[model samples]
Structures are given as structure tokens and as C-alpha cells.
Target: MAGRGEKTVRAVRRPEVRLPQLAAYDGGELEAEGDYDGLEFADADWAGQSARGARFMDCAVRRCALDETVLGRARFIDSVLSGVRGVGTDLSQASLRDVEVSDARLGGTQLHGAVLERVVVRGGKIDFPNLRQAKLRDVAFEGCVLVEADFAGAVLERVTFDDCTLTRVDFSEARMTDVDLRGAAALDIARGIDRLSGAVISPAQLLDLAPVFAAQIGVRVE
Candidate 1:
């Protein structure tokens, strides 16, 4: 386990998604247990739709609106979601593997109990993301802004936050392994300051979080 101030030396494995020719999807409403493969969903409005247990593979969803959409237990493999905007989008228990989510603007997104592996989220702003009890492995967040993200009880392994800003993130009961927070632009933890045994942060971050650490251990610094 690396110390709080020490940086994790392990390099995170990033995803390399190579897409093929995609067919345009002409579906009107989302169907439950729908199977979408190699499809391109451009500028589709999926507001207030339910796609429970759907499977999406080798697909691209660009500029889509997902407001109040339910995607519970959905599986997304080798897919890309770019410029997607949403509010109150429910993705509970969803599985994302080798996926790229870029330039997204989401609010109140529910991802509790989700499984994400080899996923990259780049250049996005996410607010109030609920990732409680989720398992994340080999995931990277680059140049993103997360506001009030709840990561309580999540398991993170080999996760990297590169140039990402995390504001008021809750990591209570979350277990981490080789989770690198060294490259984060700004990190503010709302809870669980003592659960950083396996995770690593830069010296500047350590200094920035010193007050929280001191409060956790009942130490007062003048």
C-alpha cells in the first residue's frame, strides 16, 4: 500500500477503441432488453425512456439526450458516447467495458452498483454521479469535472484521474488498489479521509487535504 503522499508507480492501462463501420439506428423508443450492435445513435432523444437490461456493443452514441432515461443492468462493450447530455439518467448496475465517454454533460446520473473496466471518460462535466458500490478497474478520467460525486462503498483498482477536478466527492467505505489521484487538478473529499491506504496522491494534494487528515486523527494544527 502506498502512503498518502506517495505516488503510485503502477501505470494504468488505457483503452484503445477501434470502431468499424456503424449502421444508423432508426428506433423510436428504447425497448427493454434491446440489443444494439455496431449502431450509431446520433442526435437521438432518449428522454424518459427505459432500456432495462439492454446490451450495446461496438456502438457509438453521439449528441444524444438521455434525460430521465433508465438503463438498469445494461451492458456496454467497446462503445463510445460522445457529447451526450443528460439529467437524472439512471444507469444503475450497468456494465461498461472498453468504453469511451467524452465531452458529456450529465447531472444527477445514477450509476450505483455499476461495473466499469477499461473505460475512459474524457473532457466532460458530471454532477451528482452516484457510483456507490460500483467496481471500477483500469478506468481513466481525463480533463473532466465532477461535482458532488458519490463514490461511497465503491471498489477502484488501477484507476487514474488525469487533470480531473473532483469537488465534494464522498469515498466512504470505498476500497482502492493502485488508485492514482496524483494527476487530479483538484480533489475535495467530503468523507472517508482515512480510507486512502491503498490509494496515492501527490504531495500538493496531501498538503491540501492535511486539514481533513488532521481532523480525522483528532490533531489540531496551529
Candidate 2:
């Protein structure tokens, strides 16, 4: 079943952009120079553009739409990204440290080989997102909905998914350590228990697992 899903995902290709190129600017509408850092880009429409090897430090990117944007080897440190729609964006080899992303939509986003540390994602919908070969440490996801998200071959440490809804989310072949799933809704957990090998849960979650144990032990309950 997983193999079939992968094949289906590979079959569907995203649409290409056809709009005129938008001029790239740096801080205070200045021309972007080499190794751009400490830039603030708010309410900018940077769609269908690739930002590679750029360093965005202490930036506030609000109400921006980076649809179909390719961001490779870029660093976003101490950034605030709110109300952003990064659909079909390729964020490969990107590093996002101490960033907060809220009210965002990241549909069909590719996060391969990305490093996310001390990041918080809240109130967002991340559909069909890929995190393969990514390293996530001290990342918190709160009040977000993830549909068909993939985390294959990823390394996750101390990641928390609080009040998130995960449907058809894949964590296959992911290395997870010190993962806390406390206060998470059981119905949000997609796939089988065997797939979640290294996940830690609270006692309330044990109540949800009681029925599986009861069935295995042949216990009769009212």
C-alpha cells in the first residue's frame, strides 16, 4: 500500500509558472547583494522564484505567498513567517532555526534534506508535504492539520505535535527519538501502531490503546 501511494504521488506533477519575473530586492527595497542577511520581507509576493544560498536573519515575512518557489541551501534564522502560502515550494537543503510559522499553508512542499531546529508551526495546513532526509530537533507543531505528509528517512528529536490532526501521514523509515505525543488526539494518529516505533505518549493515550490490548489478550469488556 505504501509503495502504491508513493507511485501515485510521483505520477502527479505540479503546474509551472507563467507570470512575468518579479524584481528581487533586499532590505529597504535595496538591490540584493551576495550573502544577504538580516532582511525583512513582509507582505511580498515572491512566487515562482528560487532563493538559493541566501541567509535571511531576523526577518519578518508576513502575508507573503511563495508559491512554487525553490529555496535551496537557504538559512532562515530567527524569522517570523505568518499567513504565508508556500504551495508546491521546494525547500531542499534549507535550514530554519528559531523560526515561527503560523497560519500558513504548505501544500505539496518538498523539505528534503532540510534542518528545522527550535521551530514552531501553528494553525496551518501542510498537505502532501515531504520531509525526507530532513533533520528536525526541538520542533513543535501546534494546532496544525497535516494530510498525507511524508517523513521518510528523516531524523526527529524532541519533536512535539500538540493538538494537530494528522491524516494519512507517513513516518516510515524515520528515526525518532525523545518524541512526545502527549495531549495529542488519538484519532489524529494515522497508520498502525507498529509504524510508530519510537514515539512516546501519555497515559491518556494508553486508554486509546486499551482496546487493542484487550483484543490481543482475549478479554471481554462491556
Candidate 3:
């Protein structure tokens, strides 16, 4: 659990099989071996429903709304989404294992090519979340806010952004290995930052992003 550039964390990749417990559901299409365990979707709405390839285990969605829900390739395990709002939600290529999105409110959420293993976005409020080409493994964004989220060409493994609230979040052409933005709340107000090669910030978040790493290599930090 060292600081900057520390690698060697790539776990969460569960769900090899097991998932056979059906019953309880008030929404629409969620076929493909449907098995929503311990179901209890409260305040359900499921607008524009279409949960493709469904298979949610230990489900428990409260204050559910799922606005414009499509959930392509759905397959959440040990789920638990509270205060779910999901505006313009698509969840493209979804898989989210061990999910636990609390106080959710995903705005313009699409999650392009999603997979997010061992997810845990607490007190969420994700805005403009695209997560292009997503695959984020062992994810964990506690007390989230993630505004302008994109994660272009994403693949970030062992992700972890604790004190979240990354303003202009957007990792252009991302591929960060053991990504861990040191409990970010201001990684220089997050943007592209040269794609944050193999991210793992710490050490005071690299001295508070050192003026955005000297204006992206131009090095004129006067």
C-alpha cells in the first residue's frame, strides 16, 4: 500500500458460474437465465426497461427509477443499489459484480463497454458517465461525485478513488494498470493529464499534480 506509482493490484474477476435463484420481479424483459436473488426492488419505475442478459444475485434496489434503462449485457452479483435514479441510463455491456452503488443518481450514464468488477460507488452522483471502452476491475469510488466522467478507452485495473469528486474527470485513451488516484478530491481538477500513464498517484498526489505536471510537459511552471 505504498504511495506513487505502486503497482501489483489486480484482483476482482469473480463470477465463473454459479447463479441459480429466481423469483420476484415487477419490471419487463430480463430473460436469459434470469435469476434475481433475494429480490426487493422498492419504489420501482424501470423506465424504458430492457435488462438484456439479466442475472442479478442478492438484489435489493431501493427508490429505484432506472430512467431510460436498457442495461445491455446485464449481470450484477451481490447487488444493492439504494436511492437509484439512473438518468438516461444504458449501462452498455454491463457486468458489475459485487455491486453496491449507494445513494445513486447516475446522470447521462451509459457505461460504454462496461465490466466494473467488485464495484462500490458509494453516495454516488456520477454525471456524464460514459466510461468508453470500460473494464475497470476491483473498482471503488467512495463518496463519489465524478463530474464530466468519461474515462476514454478505459481499462483501468485495481481502480480506487476514495474521497472522490473528480471534477472534470476524463482519462483520455486510458489504460492505467493499478490505478489509484490517492483518494482524489482534486487531482488537479482531473482532465486528461497525458492519459495518466499507469496511474497510482500519492506523495501528496504528486505535490498536488505539480501544476498539472508542468502544463502537460511544456514545463513552464513559473
Task: Report clashes for each candidate as comma-separated counts.
Answer: 0, 0, 0
The CA lDDT of each predicted structure is: 0.93, 0.70, 0.75
Better of 1 and 2 by TM-score: 1
- What is the TM-score (0 to 1) of candidate 3? 0.34
**Candidate that scores best on lDDT:** 1
Off by over 4 Å in 2: 1-34, 186-192, 203-222
lDDT of candidate 1 over 1-222, digit per residue (tens): 385455345777777888889999986788899998999999999999999999999999999999999999999999999999999999999999999999999999999999999999999899999999999999999999999889899999998889999999999999999988989999999998877878888778988999999999999999
Model 1 regions lying over 4 Å from their true place: 1-7
Tens-digit per-residue lDDT, 107-140, candidate 2:
8988889999888888978888888889988888
Colliding residue pairs in candidate 2: none
Query: Lowest summed lDDT over 10 consecutive residues: which window, candidate 3?
Result: 11-20
User: Using TM-score as the measure, what is the rank order of every candidate, best first?
Assistant: 1, 2, 3
TM-score for all models, in order of appearance: 0.96, 0.75, 0.34
lDDT of 3 by residue, 1-222 (tens): 333554555543433423245345666655554667777677878887776777777777788888888877788887777888868988788888877777788798888898888777777687888889889888778777878888888888878877887877778777787777777776544667877766667778788778876887888865
Instruction: Give the least accurate 10-residue stretch of model 2, judged by summed lDDT.
Output: 8-17
Q: Model 1's lDDT to the true fold? A: 0.93
Error of 3 at 74 (Å): 18
What does candidate 1 score on TM? 0.96
TM-score: which is higher, 2 or 3?
2
